[model samples]
Target: MPFELEVCIDNIESLSTAIAAGATRIELCSSLALGGLTPSFGFMQQAAKQSTVPIYAMIRPRQGDFLFSPQEFDLMLADINAAQEAGLSGIVIGALTASGEIDTKNCRNLIKAALGMGVTFHRAFDLCKEPTTALEEIINLGCERILTSGLAPTAEAGSEVLKQLNELAKGRISLMAGAGVNQSNVKGIIQQSGITEVHLSGKGFRNSLMTFNSSNAKMGADEVDDSQIPVTQHQAVANVKAVLDSLS
Candidate 1:
């Protein structure tokens, strides 16, 4: 079977670029630098309207950690509902307990809220204290897929554990290799991780549109300042697809 490539998009430009470049699936988000925050309703609406491929909007309320407060959890469920109402194909959602295990209670609630829409348990899987045990519980929760880098910073580096998880998954759920995936390493990642679905941003940095010396101060919480914004490259997306196709 041909491997599935799920492009991670954060804006209308990336959305158009990915769609035009023949992406069949996309993970729609807002601040991908913050590990993907929930997108605005208007953004979701526009993406759904313009997209020909399946778009799964991220359900994260904020950046920081997978551990969420009660209020934050509530917000996540509300966001899931809104994304579904916006006609998105799926929702990427995940949360962890303080002890570093899947918050089955909250996660199941989110899944229940999703109902007919597809559900992907995000990279929070990498933060679990007991990953193997967590996998069985996640499978029991009926998530459509799990996006992981095998508890490593990158899928290529985590290929060993990624392959192990795929074996344990045993077709009960899909294991999508993600994080630091690029054209040069995509082929090796697929061969070693044994994953059918791969997730990446297909993005490159662009200088701020401002010609003026905009702001000497930064606004973003992390090191990802606005000076260089991530924009998807149509050729990058196409190259990933082309490389994957060549392997098949």
Candidate 2:
């Protein structure tokens, strides 16, 4: 199969950059520092208007654990409906039990709700107590792919487990390595894990255009510089795509 690079982006600017830089797919979300949350319906609609590649809206209701409350599940269902209405191509989603097992029932419902759209089970797969078991469950749930770091903090660190998962998958489902992926290490991760697909934000920070700053105005976290906005760098995305193309 041909290799694919899926770029994750949190804003319109980054969405444009990723596509210009050769992303085969786009994972649209909000609050990347919070590990990505479901984007607003307006953002989804605008992205659909701008993006050339297939855009998969992240279906996460919050930033914490994937064990969602019933209310949160209802919110996710609503978000899925909104994504469909916005003309998105698919959704990236995941759910787990408190004990670290795949929440099969909830996931099945999500897949059913997302019916015609392509489904990618997100990184909550990394938290599973049993990777192989979770892999089977995800495939049975009809997820077309699993985006994971192989239970480690980064794809490079988890390359071994990623390789094992790839071998076990045996083409049953696509295994896409993500988390801390960059141009420097992407080639190695793909080589070691034997996965044809990869995901990354290719993120970089830029100073806000505002020339004035008020010391008392702190709407976000105390440490974060609200003036500095996160953007997906076109060069960063291009470099990784070049590396993938260079590989046999």
- Output the number of the TM-score-best candidate: 2
What's the lDDT of the predicted structure labeled candidate 1?
0.89
Residue 213 of model 2: what lDDT? 86
**Candidate 2: clashing pairs of residues:** none
Tens digit per residue, CA lDDT, model 2, 3-85: 89999988998988999898999999999899999999999999999888999999999989999999999999999999999
Compared with the true structure, model 1 gives a TM-score of 0.93
Q: After superposition, how far is residue 130 of candidate 2 from its true place, in Å?
A: 0.9
Error (Å) of candidate 2 at residue 88 is 0.4
How many collisions per candidate? 0, 0
lDDT tens string, model 1, 1-248?
78788999898888988877758798999988778999999999999998989999999999988999999988988888888888999999889999999999999999999978999999999999999999999999999999999999998999889999999999999999999888899899888877888888888877888877656677766666677778898888888888888987
Clashes of 1: 0
Lowest lDDT sum, 10 consecutive residues, model 1, at 213-222
Identify the runs in model 1 with alpha carbons over 4 angstroms from their true place: 207-227
**Against the hidden reference, what TM-scores do the models get?**
0.93, 0.98
Q: Given candidate 2, what's the lDDT at residue 77? A: 97
